[model samples]
Target: MSVTDKDRDILTRTLWGEARGEGLAGQIAVGWTIRNRVDDGKANSWWGESYAGVCQRPYQFSCWNKSDPNYAYLSGAKPIPPREFAQAQIAADQVMAGMVQDPTRGATHYYATSMPKPPVWVKGAKETLRLGHHIFFSDVP
Candidate 1:
């Protein structure tokens, strides 16, 4: 699950409101975010550098490679396929969903889609979960 500079650049560039509004951008953002968080130490919280620091759970799990003593707990095996990546995305989405508010405050909610309109409030946080499954899990190219 080693992340590269390209991955970070892609996530940072694509995870913005404009890119997120577009479904494809949103999907890639989510995927790239998950991968970067795991490989690097980036946090995906709404506040980039607020009290909420970057999440490190993914990094902890990614520490284990096939040769590492704790590899089993880190991940099942090498080269986690797209399906597995999607599963991780879903799990991350579930966690993120819990953090979102229905009538979100200005600072509490963050948009991930790149739709043409202004920042559209997420109708339902579950949309992220569905997106995770569809983009990361499905075999769509």
Candidate 2:
């Protein structure tokens, strides 16, 4: 255990909550979006100050919301599936260590493909990449 142990753990859980069904590459893409926010080169970024902050930021990753089904598991009230969690950990480690290419191309925003329509913020945003069931975006401002 170390200073970033919790950060890594939260990031891993986030990957699992948000992209577990998408498999390794999907988790990695989601991880890079978080990493991009963390390294967005701004003091006190709106995205949040750290990995955990960004992941748990209100309304950002729906999984962390108390009402979301994944919240209990991420919060430890419920246990995550060992095998799926292990895959998320690998994706988190790769993104955290900068060991994988950013498939989203520095995207900081995304929406599930299942959404009936794109979120309003996407109106003027640049589409970056689309993989699995998520569509990535950048330059949201």
Candidate 3:
């Protein structure tokens, strides 16, 4: 799949919002999860038809949710630290260019392990990877 400048920008912001504290490897894992979502044949239409679509899709990536703590930064109402934004951009470029293999191993879903309760959807899904604070899953039915 080819990534447009818009797609790269959206993905970079998403990495900044979702995985900024998790460092480069964490950002890459998050990027692959988004790519996996874009590639999932069975995802609901609201899940998105493109990178921007998915990342901005309501109620999907919580960082875009109005109530989410990261919304202000993600929505451009606040600035992301220059260093963090630069790191996220690097992660986005690598993934969009396929310069590094997917570290999530086809995972389309993930949640921070720090969440007190795992989402109900994880029940029957296969756990595919754990990097930083996130746990990734696939083969959901």
* Distance from true location, Cα of 31 in model 3, Å: 0.2
Stronger candidate by TM-score (1 vs 3): 3
Q: Return the number of clashes found in candidate 2.
A: 0
TM-score per candidate: 0.22, 0.96, 0.93
Best candidate, lDDT-wise? 2
lDDT for each residue of candidate 2 in 1-141, tens digit (9 for 90 to 100)? 122887899999999999999999999999999999888989878988889888989989999999999999999999999999999999999999889999999899999989899899998899999899999999997
Off by over 4 Å in 3: 41-46
Clashing pairs in 1: 18-114, 20-112, 20-113, 20-114, 21-113, 21-114, 21-115, 22-114, 22-115, 43-54
* Candidate 1 wrongly placed segments (more than 4 Å): 1-78, 99-141
RMSD for all candidates, in order, please.
14.5, 1.8, 1.7
Superposition error at 61 for model 2 (Å): 0.6
Better of 2 and 3 by lDDT: 2
Best by TM-score: 2
